[model samples]
Target: MESTGIQRLFYILWAIIKLNLYILVFTLAGGIVLGMGPAFQSANDVLLTSGMDYQNITFGKMAERFKANFKRSNGIFWIFAALLGIVAYNLFLASQIKGLLWFILSFVLFFAILLLLVVYLYAVQYETTYDISIGNLLKLAFISVFLNFGTFLKVLFGVISILVVTWFFKGLLLFATFSLFLVWSGYATKNIRQLVEGKLG
Candidate 1:
């Protein structure tokens, strides 16, 4: 029996609260240096692993996976950080030039690319679950987003929902909002694994 949308949402929430919290602990602890890259990868791994029908995950296993994820995708994290720095500098320059339109467009483009990069990271994690190479995984991330646009949007919505919820209940950070978002987004992408894998393979 297929789950209703509400049921799936609750399932996603519980998965984060349960299976993915260990990784969140690491993320919150090392967030400044790690930049949520490990957390996102670990949460994606948890959801993808579960989606693939694996069972009986433990906190220790999640932590090990978190380390592996950080190793595999840290480069992407650095690239994201660099791009953010560049965009910030450009925005500052635009402000100095009094180019209001340029500033607005740059800001919009930053977010647009950031959102796409978020989806790409999700795809990267899914690929990493099967031991796909970092190079190939990067290629698949780009393709998967367009190939599975609807699923991408679902994941995006799940992410935005987490932000909204977190804004209202700031205490949710204690409960690990970023972890929840990753797991929720991962759950949203579960159905598309085969679709992506087929094309990737």
Candidate 2:
């Protein structure tokens, strides 16, 4: 049992490493700005399809998935990126103010950022797993975040934990941080996706 467990652990680690490398290479292939969106989309698709087992992961598969959704992925990526930029700019402006108004604005802006992050997380998964139009995909993903608030909290905690671990290790940022994040997000949001699907159907 101990040997089997150790082997499983090794296998997962190796898979994550390979995934990280795939994401990096593909992201650069699209020239970073263009590459990033498809890279993440492909990663999520590959991970979900494989049931997180990562045993069937390959460069060819990643490339195929990346090319499959190249344009759509970039559209989704830019839409959220613009929203994030606006919120971040507001956050920076809020930091310049003082007293209670600053506190209030800061709180609201931060929450908005969180909500956006949650929606983006769900958006990627939804796009990968379903055939919904981009408009509805974003709308449903935004709504699902609130409907599945408990799961959202779990995802939030998992993200923080991963960030904390990576902060200390540093190297994990390059090697496993994103792959691990995609794994956690996929697992955490599985039920939420099912619930959303059932309701929509």
Candidate 3:
């Protein structure tokens, strides 16, 4: 049992390393700025579809997925970028102000960012899983966050845990961080996705 558990850990680590390499290579292939979206979508696709079945994860498959998702992934990326920019500007404005209004605005904007974060995470996963319009995808992801608030919290916790660990062991940022987060996001959202599917059916 102990040796089996160790082997499982090794396999998980190896998979994450390979995923990290794939994301890095593809992101650079698009010159980082252009590559970020498609690369992320491709990685998310593998995580959702393959789960722990890392044997089937190949660079060619990732490339194919990245090419297929390029346009739609970029659309999602730019939209979220715009929204995040707006919120960031608001945050900057809040920083310049003083008094109760500033406090309230900051508080509201904090949750707004969180809402956007949850929606963005779900949006990326749903894009790969469903063939829905981006407009409807955003709406569904937004609604799902509230409806599946527990899942949101679980994902949030996983993210925080990873971030905290990465803070102490910064080497993870080099490779494992994003891939680990993707793994957690895939696991955290699985049940909520099933529930949504059941309701739709």
User: Top TM-score: which candidate number?
Assistant: 2
Per-model lDDT: 0.64, 0.88, 0.86
**Ranking of all candidate structures by their TM-score, best first:** 2, 3, 1
Model 1, residue 117: C-alpha shift (Å): 3.9
TM-scores of the candidates in the order shown: 0.71, 0.96, 0.94
lDDT (Cα, tens digit) per residue for candidate 2, span 1-201: 999999888888988988988888999999999999899889988887775466788888999999998999999999999999999899999988899989899999988887887788899989987887899989988888888679999988888899899999999978998888788888898898898789878
Tell me the tens digit of each residue's lDDT in model 3 across 75-187. Answer: 99889989988998898889789999898999898778877877888888788788989999998888888886788899888988998999999888777987887888778
The CA lDDT at 144 in model 2 is 87
Off by over 4 Å in 1: 1-14, 28-32, 51-55, 88-104
> Candidate 1 on 1-201: residue-level lDDT in tens?
356877776765665566445555767756647836765666566655665222444566667777776765567766666766776676566656546787787677666655665656565566556666666666666666776778877877777787898899987876658666655656676667677667657
- Candidate 2: C-alpha RMSD to true structure equals 1.2
How does model 3 score by TM-score? 0.94
Pairs in clash, predicted candidate 2: none
Of candidate 3, the 10-residue stretch with the lowest lDDT total is 48-57
